[model samples]
Target: MAMGHYVNYYRLEMAQQREEEGEEAGVKRSAQYMALLTGPGFTGHVLALILFLMVTSSVERVRRKGFETFWYTHHLFILFFITLMFHGAFCFIRADTPPYCKSSPGSYKFVLGSLFFYILERTVREIRARLPTAISKIVLHPSKVLEVQIKKSSNQHGDGFFRAKAGQYVFLNCPDISAFEWHPFTITSAPEEDYVSVHIRIVGDWTTAFAKRLGCSFDDEQQFWIEELKNRTSNGVGGGEETISGVGVGAASGSSSAVAMDSMAFGSGASLMGGAKQRASASANSLQLQRPTEPTITLPRVLLDGPYGSPSEDAFNYEIAVLVGAGIGVTPFASVLKHIWYSVMQPTKIITLRKVYFFWVCRDRDAFEWFQDLLIALEEQNLTGFLEIRSYLTGELGKEEMDTVLMEARAAAAAAAARHFRNKHYYGGGGGDGADVGNQGFEGKGGEGDLLTKLHKPLGGSGAFPMEVMLGEEMNGSNETLSDARRDRDAITGLRSPTYYGRPNFDKIFGELALAHPQEHGQVGVFFCGPKPLGKTLHRCARKYKFKFHKENF
Candidate 1:
């Protein structure tokens, strides 16, 4: 029905046009009709298809290359919108233009508010990105994990302290990195903590480059600068048109150069061509300027943009929560664990979370070192049995070797416990019974730095967490250090149960949780951030046992 009506309307229009423009002229105009194909409308339509391709074709590459292709290509949206505006406001075929269409003019007025808000939001974001953020602490961890701990700049943070929920994240930008790219990482510190921290695992291209920048020398940095500039051509900086237009422009510096740049930003045709020549010439001049002899400070200027909420942000809402992470994905739960730790220590802190089960599954043993200190400390304090952490190491090792690892882990725990006891005893002088369990106090993070260091102190064999069992010597020296009753000590640490050798049995784990928390028919918040496959398995388990499961992925 619609096609028949359009056909009749088209015939009427052609007949009217024939009468007004005489038959010969009307026929010639019909032959030349290509209104939508050669102007802004065509450009906008082409850009739409390009953007669709960008989103669809780069799906796999985005995962491997750290979103660079997606990030850079997505900027074409600016051109897309601009061309769309031009396309809508102008008309090539003018049959309806004299008294415009009654139904609608164009989409511009309708989207004005949305466009303005987006522009405002981006302007604020760019302003925030321009500020320099200081990294207060850099804790280099094993397994290529680098933690850049930064404090909120008082001048920049403004008003109150920078606040975030347990499982939120922030977008990080480093000028030395790409100047435009920002990556997201989970907030690993508690909201109440003085400093904010992001644990970056050296995995993708951007992270690897950042690691290089941190360790490179002065000469290496200069070389990197040249290479980085050259790479910018493909990264959406340099252009053939700019190079051509900038030809024969004068020096790299001057008022005329500034004028040329401004002209280039808004000019077109021959004027734009000349401006591009000037810009390219200026760029070449810049490349020739003598390098600073005194190496400029090489520390990359990093900026932060958000404390955006993720799915796991609501973990505190549920009384019974299960926080799970695998590999670097454990960062979100770190914040939750810290929060839970504080809640356990300070009984008066108002919070709904009564219990938290943290599970960290890793592929390498060295990865355990990242959170070992914090988790061990949590276990040593026993935090009223409110926090339970479970680590699964899926590395390839024999049963005997696995047993050795388990024994070593237990012994490590026992040693930490002894240290907690002796550190207090020494602080109280030699008068108190060092082994007195009633006097144990591991409530606050005040002495966190000294927590492990105090363990290194010689307690004159009064042995809080002792150096009696050295894991290094035992693991290397013999197969004889393995224990039969090592399973008994698995429950010793509140941080985690025994480190399991393989993957977890999700069905069994959820069943146990469901049984334990069934008294009030309470909901168990199963929060996870990890591989999609594991999350899917967890989702099935949640559905089977009637638990609410939430996950956040990058």
Candidate 2:
């Protein structure tokens, strides 16, 4: 571009010469200037191009090795700006005067309005990000993603003085990692959550090193489950005060643990405040231990700036939302989804949301653990009709392989459920199925403790969708073996939506959504937070069919 501009400048000068003297007269220049330009300018341009390539060569390689290389090399743009400013300040020809008039061009001349503002913006950003912040929580998800929840000090609200809308992002600066480096991360926590949170994927050197500063890694979930099972074993005969009939063993043991936990909560927080233990006791079922078996490690300090708007924040404006996310790209949508959940959980603030369709596609089953608890809590809220989550596991596996994996997972969940129910029955009296024990009668039990009557059995008969989605057939005694097999399979992976294989068909999804909500009557907002190619596909589909498309590409 600079060469083109210089070429045009010479052309204009030659045209002026041709007009001043007849066409016979030609343009003239000093041999000294010509020699210098022809020799050094040619060499300089070539060398600059070579240097550019060298800096850009194997970007992925350098990116993996260190982000500082990418950062420092990109700063070479300032040198280019400086050279161009000097080049513009000097002119080789001038027809308006006998001698070409040249001096340092006004400093303001070198400053493009946008560039000045940009530099100013960055300066402000540095100061803002320098504001001190404390890391309240650091969750190392099973998928090697780090979520940092930062608490901002405020004069009021006790939550955060820095408020950010859903789908917005912020710049995180951890001086411990690098004093100069500032990384942008999408805010994963909803505005409803007091603190700001960012999900960082450990894919590059900077991120990997940053995550290590927390000094904790995600332990194997399987080991945790094994330890839990070991702890559930009865220490005394007759299970020492069993409660319910079928799931009594698991419940009674869990109750003893719960009482011990409540006592610990009260003891630990007794001096802090009376409400500390009460608050801890209230969330006993939240799965937070009174005292974590692993000691909590002190994490390094972090700083944050901004809550810049992204495409996803607009989703709240629409009545219907269809969110598609792939792997770690799902950060932006996490905030939106959390906002929706918050709306449902706290109904004081009116929410205009009618429906939310979230489709998350990841490569491995292990990735699902990140949001599994949140998804289950939302499902338990009976928002099935409002918020539909479609998760896809894209892996090369046979039909039998997938089913076998799901069955094993379900068996583990079932065992955990039985234990939970036993604890609930032993402590107070609520059934594990979210049913109130007061409604379940003990009139026939010789009052033999309280017996939890099973309601709407998935297996005990009464024809309830057959539990097995593979075969929709009404099974009779003739296919008793098949029925048993289906029931067992269904119990292994019950009501939770099944994970599908491969990518989702956008056409099928849009077509179904279109049929469900007419375009002429209602507008559908299709939100995508993923790769550029996927967004392009969605954009094409949205344009071909009439749905408003919004995207947040990382």
Candidate 3:
């Protein structure tokens, strides 16, 4: 009886273990299915989450302070949390499925690891807010731009100068009695250089003061003579007697510039008194204790935000690249050109890029002169042969000139489309299904034939009558045909033919470049950072030429 009982117990244990394994397998399968659905196929879900967040936030703000103040205090956290939860769910589902699990256990581990990193990144940002202030010193002094240099730093041995890409900008802060105010200035230095610099045009209120404060003068100058006379009288023997004598001398030198110079000389006296008074008053004002001394004009505390941009090295792989900049739009391309030069010319890893064209539109020579040195240096490196620079002045692009440019661009696009169509028919195997080839076919009737052959037919490719095509015929046709067309007349009359107007033909540029350097390998990638209209035009043109385009907005 004891032996039989032990045998039964062992069998029961085995059965329980098998049941646990089955449950574990189901859990894994569920996780895997979730991941696959969410990965690329569930983009709609992500968009829905975004919309939900937007609506929820709007509703919450309306409840808080009515619609008038809703625009000011809408918390963005509603949208942020919605997206976070959706993204997390997406990743969780992708890790446990059959196909995903068929790989080694290492793949599952990687998904978990990425999730860990995401959590850590958020945690660090949360802790950062409680940290101490980053800025150490603030200066509020006026400085004139006496000279500008666009060369590498002299001291390479130090912590290495902050390297900047061509078009990136830096913020400069000048301390005032109120609070620190910062101005953004573009860096003219290329990425390969050790140091960066900016060229500033003295046009603002601060710049004007800087010029007056920092400029030097000769003693023979009217202002200097008055300053010397004042010093002499101040030091003369007998205080009461000297005071009378100073008044007499001041009366004699009766010039406005002299009076202005004297005022500046006395300005230092007031500053000294101000400093002393600030020290005495510090105990009463707690805020003064946090402020730094030395009254710096050029603040040493600069906050660098980003090396922000898309991949630049990818441009080297393209056969043809076109860069267009209007005014300051040239900034991002500066980084691109620098990347190309280093990647192609470096001895260790030489990648031969084919051709680059740059078109810069500016109002005056001064704009070009700002970064002309860098352009000249690039030309000197014998890179100009591979690069074309065209400048269009404001007046140079009038209505007639713009019209011509647009026409040329369009013509180029049409020609490229024609070539692409020809190539597809001859070499690339014709379209698998008979479809409308440029405003030719209607829905439902499928045919199998060459596109060119269909284009030549008198019926113009489709039997299911196009509403617009029948409109003119019906208007002039017999009364019987008009009655039949009257039922659908609105649809026919409303239809408008597609026209290519105010559009850029990017196909011409891409096709010409491709033809010029057929030996160059890899896919064409076009990057554009500009105004909306220009970017849209380039995108349309790129599509025509079959080149990939990426656009970034400022």
Candidate 4:
């Protein structure tokens, strides 16, 4: 559309030059004369063209990298639209006849209504976003995923709280980070929850910087663990409990121990308050935890523009819903699943769907930490057998990685035990008196618990071990095939459903769904949020199975 408009405008300029000058003079100076016509109309066209090219080029140039570049360039639309109102003001395009062809500034008239609405929309959004919004909480998960919880304060009348349905999104603008940049993120928290939350994977510059500002540090070489080991040999003041936050974040396969950071500056006056253990305790099942210290940091002001509708918002309308997410694409499904859990847990709540199948395909096992707790919570309720979750890890976990996790677990357990023994003899600390020092090595009922259980913290008492141990060395018969299979715990996620090694077999999955829900069950709705290629594959499957398909338009 823009190209066609520009082509016509260029022809009009040529015609106008011919009328102003003689045909002979126009032919002699067509290019120079056209360039010299620096009226508002011609200048607007040029500016619009430049803005269009810059925006399009920046999107491709950044690829998966520079988010700031794309964000800044995309805002050129404001200037582009302003220029467009004057694009044909001078009326260069002359009619065939004379009297009807008088130059009149009518371009603005053509766009006046739309421009008014556009301005009005932005004005309303800006005013609403600025109204007393606060960052309630922030959680830094593995794989550089940051979860932010936002709370909206109501007016004096106790009205105007932000309301949204499941599978919706919001435009977030943090002025402390960037004054003009606003990014859209799926709302992972359900409408039933009091606060709105979003899970952001720290991939681009804006996101990486945002995570760091929220108290997470990144490292390429070290796997940072947050362990809260209560020191028995306390300070002379009172032996009060101390909480330390770990600074480094890297791949889960790293062998190095955690790096503890105290008084780490995050936001303005903000310090690290809770350890990862406390953070895990405050997952989807739990939202708040009492910290030992009152947090002094003032969280950055974040403006939110929406709880906008999305394709996945229509998920519950279907009798059978198949939700497919890839990596951070699982964010939208988080809301869907949470809403489903709420609906199922409360019998009075009405929901259209009778069955749901959620498939998450991620590259890293640690990435599962982003939404594993929510999935586990839903699983615990059984949801009346209405929901099924199948997770796939496309990335290969080599044997060496498994061995490294095992070694790290052993080292951590040994270190904790050594501390316990040292404290017991030197500080006269007693064992099993319910102190953290005493239970460091024996948190589980059985022998030395593995790091997998510690990392994920499954709801079950006897959680998963890193790997199978030798015959006599096994703590609770970890080598028994029947018992291990019965445990139904993935070594990585520690969930009842084991994570698949490679890509999911979509054909088999679709075939089973088709067989299970025949035509009588009504059309199955397949909602997906992922890359274009996987969406295409799913679209094909949907077509072959005669199901409705919906892909999120990010």
* Best candidate according to lDDT: 4
The model with the greatest TM-score is 4
Cα RMSD (Å) per model? 18.1, 12.9, 27.4, 11.7
Q: Where does candidate 1 stray beyond 4 Å?
A: 1-24, 28-36, 57-63, 90-105, 130-132, 155-161, 216-297, 398-496, 520-522
What lDDT would each prediction earn against the true structure? Answer: 0.57, 0.56, 0.38, 0.62
Taking all chains together, each candidate's TM-score versus the true structure is 0.64, 0.65, 0.37, 0.70
Give the clash count for each candidate.
12, 2, 9, 2
- The candidate 3 region of ten consecutive residues with least summed lDDT is 243-252
Candidate 4 C-alpha lDDT tens digits along 1-554:
54665565567655554444455553433433444464644775567676766657576546457767676666676677667766656555456666545555566776678879988999999887767766665665666677887775577997756888999999988787888788899999998887899988777878877766665656642122221121111111111222233332221112233323243312210111112222233333311112354233344568888879999999989989999999889899899898887877776767778888888888775676676667767878966478877777676445654454354334445555677677776787665553455345443424544322323321113433334321111212221110011133444454565555456767667877888888633558999999988999999988888888999974
* lDDT by residue for model 2 (1-554), tens: 54664565466545544322475356554333342464434444644764675468438677557777776666666666555555434443444765455554664565687578879998888777666566655555544667777776565555455889999998877776788777789988888877888878877767877766664333464235323322331111111111111111110111223111111111121111111111223332322222224332345667777978899998888888889998888888888888888888887776666888888877754455455546656777989889987666554434543344334333333444555566667866454553543323221123432222222224222332222222212111111111111122222112255455446678767877777877432568888887777889898888767889987856
Clash count, predicted structure 2? 2
Error of 3 at 415 (Å): 45
Q: Residue pairs in steric clash, candidate 3?
A: 32-96, 32-97, 34-93, 35-93, 35-94, 139-296, 140-296, 140-297, 141-297
1 or 2, which is superior by lDDT?
Answer: 1
